[model samples]
Target: MIELGLPWVLATLPLPILAWRFLPRAKERRAGALRVPFFDEMIGSVRAGVLGRVKRFGAIAAMIGAWSAMVVAAAQPSWVGEPQSIPTQGRDLMLALDLSGSMAQQDFAVNDRPIDRLSIVKAVAKRFVEDREGDRLGLILFGSRAYLQTPLTTDRETVGQMLDEAELGLAGKETAIGDAIGLAVKRLGERTAEERVLVLLSDGASNAGVMDPIRAAEFARQAGIRIYTIGIGADTRAFGGLGLMSLGGGDSLDEETLRRVAETTGGNYFRATSTEGLIEVYRRIDELEPSEGRESHVRPMRALFHFPLGAAFVLSAMLVMAHVAGALGWNWTAGRGR
Candidate 1:
């Protein structure tokens, strides 16, 4: 729909009339009458009195039209487009994934084929990101140090692509769980306290980095960042005829520290031993932290002042050309009669 931004400006449309009626006019100078023998000839030379009056009326009409166009332009007419839905508030979620050498373990399977831990994570996390339409998501890939793979943004496709391109041991071979949480807290601290969230997934303990896991968790808690820790990998596996053997012997998996980090920030700890379990863990997190409910809208606007302004210029030009043509025609006729 078309609208006027400065509708009050239209009130000035009668300003010229008001000034003409109330303002004092210049005094007309009086001259002594001089007797001239050719005064009758001079009067007869300008016999197009009716044509002169018509030209004067045409000039007034042109002036009025130009003034009207200028007034319309000053009113600031614009076209407003349809409203579009936009998210006013949504969760700011940061995902911190372990990129230590242990992430190469082929414990998870897809289509009955063994896949590495990172591969499984990339696949499942991509789906999770796609589902989070309104929320802003970020990625932090950590090994011995934590670094931002992607900043908090609504571009989920790029974030997913960044995760997929992550290589194992990109940040070094040892896990830096504390550093990951610290980085997440730093990034999410700028956002609202209620919507800040960090989901950290690691199959190893914090054997590297300057920050301690418990201390970092405390920092995150103080910063109002909810941390969800997931300890991935199978705990036990049975051999052909032997009893169950614990697969949690290596320094790779650390459930205690992960649990403490989650508990400190008032979030739940999840364990994913298989591909299905990993999917379920993300699904549960999605349920826990929902996207914003309230909706906002904005309408696009296009200015239309130029159209009226251009018309005013064209009308004024036409009036000037007409006056010049009439003056030239009168000169030609006088020259012919002479």
Candidate 2:
């Protein structure tokens, strides 16, 4: 349906009449008047009949059409479609994932069967990303050295791919928790303080990085960046031996470093022992950082100038026909006076 954006502007429809009423007339020039020979004879035949009436009515109709065009322009008529809105307060988050060799440990249980830590983390983290519908999220995978696998972006699909493609020992055999945080901060430098966040998940401690984990956490705190840390490994008792020796029955994880990182940055630390625990951890994070924000928007408008433009062309064509038919310029006195 058609609608006017500024419907109040329709009140200006009487502007043309007001112009005709209040507009001042130009002063007549004081040029000397010239005498005409047949003025009296022209006055007698002035009542030309049908042609005269047609000329007068046609001129009035043309003026009315032009005025209608102006009124429509002022009212700003447009097509009304569905309304749209988007969140305005979501933060820019960077997911710093740990792909160290220990992440391959099948100590965590998923549906009563042992699963790798990386697999559990992947599933839970992907769900968390999906829940943050409006936030611009980025991915960074690290093991021994920290590197940005994927920069900050709004395309969650691409970030998910990068996360899925990450291998156990891609960055290295060891985890570089500090380097990952530093890399995330670098990428998040473009974002504002309130919008910047780093979420890091690791199954082991930082053992091989140029930057120290404590120092990195301090840097994040100084930069006003929040870091949510997750330790993704089960205790020794969480694993069981099936037939022979249990592989992950006696493995350990670095919870202290992860907790310190989170605390220093004014964020919380979570431990994911079982797959269910991982899901609950993600749910808690969601509650803490709810994806709610103020939304503001402008309604879109489409131009409709073509409708009046086509009418103007048709009117011009009619005026041309009238001139060509010799119906106009046949004033009663023109032939006699000339």
Please give the TM-score that candidate 1 achieves against the real structure. Answer: 0.59
Model 2 — TM-score against the truth? Answer: 0.59
Q: What TM-score goes with each of the models? A: 0.59, 0.59
- Output the lDDT of residue 332, model 1: 76
After superposition, which runs of candidate 2 have C-alpha atoms over 4 Å from their true positions? Answer: 1-87, 238-251, 293-338
User: For each predicted model, how many residue pairs clash, with residues at least 3 apart or on different chains?
Assistant: 0, 0
- Per-model CA lDDT versus the true structure: 0.84, 0.74
**Candidate 1 structure quality by residue, lDDT tens digits, 1-338:** 99999999999889999999999999999899899898787565554532463466777888888988999999999999999987677889999999999889886777878788899898999999989877899999999999999999999899999988999979999988999999999999988736889999988889999999999999999998899988887555621111012235235678888888999999988877778878888998999998773477899999999999999998899877776666776787668869
Task: Give the range of the ten consecutive residues with the poorest summed lDDT in model 2.
Answer: 240-249
Per-residue lDDT tens digits for candidate 2, residues 300-329, read: 667675676567667666656655444334
